[model samples]
Target: MHFVYMLECSDGTLYTGYTTDLDNRIKKHNEGKAAKYTKFRTPVKLKYQEKFTSKSDAIKREITIKKMSRQEKLMLINKG
Candidate 1:
């Protein structure tokens, strides 16, 4: 299954992304292999995630979430 995931960084920051392997993806983030934005934001925790049947769907959800304001993202995170 694909996943749409949100991470809370050690610096009180938030990041939204998607991957098929949640564990590996988090590992990559920790190891600075995920994205440049997250590279310096080490020790990120997966605060939220949703499984999807398709990668496209997962990516679409990620895009939608990324477009949201931080407050709205927090609300969504709280709701999840």
Candidate 2:
């Protein structure tokens, strides 16, 4: 399964992305081996996630979440 996920960074910022391996992806972010944004914001915590059967769907969801304002994103995360 593909997954779209949000991370709450150590600095209180949010990061969004999609991955087939959720655990590994988060591990990479914490290890400073993922995206540049999260690399410096290490020790991120998984705040939310949605599962999709297709990679395209996961990517689309990631984009949609990325476009949301911080308040909107927080609302969504809280709902989850």
Candidate 3:
């Protein structure tokens, strides 16, 4: 399964991304190896996620989420 996920970094910032393995991806983020944004903001927490059947779909959703404002992202996470 593919996933579009949001993470809340230690600095209280948000990050959105697409992945196939949510657990491992978050592990990489916390380990400072996943994304440059999250690398510096280690110890991120999974704030939200949406599952998809295709990589394309997940990527699209990830882009959409990335475009959202901080308040909007927080709303989405709160909904989750």
Candidate 4:
């Protein structure tokens, strides 16, 4: 399975991405080995996650989430 995830950074900002290994991906972000955005915003927490059977679906969902406003993202997290 793949995943589309939202992370709340230490600075209260959000980052969205897709990964096959959710736990390891979050670990990499905290360890400063993931995306550049999360690297600077260390100590992120997983706020939301959605499972997908295919990588393409996860990627598409990630893109959709990335395009959303902060408020929208917050709503999505709340719903999750």
Candidate 5:
């Protein structure tokens, strides 16, 4: 399965991405080897995640989440 995931950073910012392994993905994010965004905003907590059968679907979800305003992102995360 692929995952569309959100992390709430220690700095109160949010990060979104698509991954095949949620556990390893979060580990990579905390280790500063995930996305460039999460690299600088380390030590994130997994706030939300959705599983999809296809990577394309997860990536599409990631793109939509990334385009959202902060408020909208927060709403999405909280809803998850």
Candidate 6:
């Protein structure tokens, strides 16, 4: 399975990305190795996730989520 996920950073910022291994991805973020943005913003927490059978679908969802305003993203997370 592929996943489109959002993370709440320690600084209260949000990040969205696609991954096939949610737990491992989050662990890499916490370890400052997953993303340059999340690297400096260590210790992020998983806020939301959506699963997809195909990687293309997950990537598309990730892009869509990344374009959302913070408030909109928060609403989505709340709904999830």
Cα-based TM-score, every candidate: 0.95, 0.98, 0.96, 0.97, 0.91, 0.97
Please give, for residues 1-80, the per-residue lDDT of candidate 1 as tens digits.
Answer: 99999999989899998888999999999999998989999989999999999988888999999999999999999999
Residue by residue across 29-70, what tens digits does model 5's lDDT show? 999998888888878999999999988888888999899999
Q: Candidate 6 residues 1-80, lDDT tens each?
A: 99999999999999999999999999999999999999998789999999999988888889999999999999999999
Per-residue lDDT tens digits for candidate 3, residues 1-80, read 99999999999998898889999999999999999998889889998999999999888888888889999999999889
The TM-score measured for candidate 4 stands at 0.97
Model 2: per-residue lDDT, tens digit, 2-77? 9999999999999999999999999999999999999888789999999999998888889999999999999999
- Pairs with backbone N, CA or C atoms under 3 Å apart (clashes), candidate 4: none
Which 10 residues in a row give candidate 2 its minimum summed lDDT?
54-63
Ranking by lDDT: 4, 2, 6, 1, 3, 5
Give the clashing residue pairs of candidate 6, or none.
none
lDDT of each: 0.93, 0.95, 0.92, 0.96, 0.89, 0.94
Per-residue error (Å), model 3, residue 54 = 0.8
Name the lDDT of candidate 4. Answer: 0.96
Instruction: List where candidate 5 sits over 4 angstroms from the true fold.
Output: none
Indicate the worst ten consecutive residues by lDDT in candidate 4. 54-63
What is the Å distance of residue 57 in model 1 from its true position?
1.2
Could you list the CA RMSD of all candidates, in the order they appear?
Answer: 0.8, 0.5, 0.7, 0.5, 1.1, 0.5
Query: Residue 58 lDDT in model 5?
Result: 84
Residue 4 displacement in candidate 2 (angstroms): 0.3
Instruction: Kindly give the stretch of ten consecutive residues in candidate 6 with the minimal lDDT sum.
Output: 55-64
> Model 3, stretches more than 4 Å misplaced?
none
Model 6 CA deviation exceeding 4 Å by range: none
Candidate 5 clashing pairs, residues 3+ apart or interchain: none
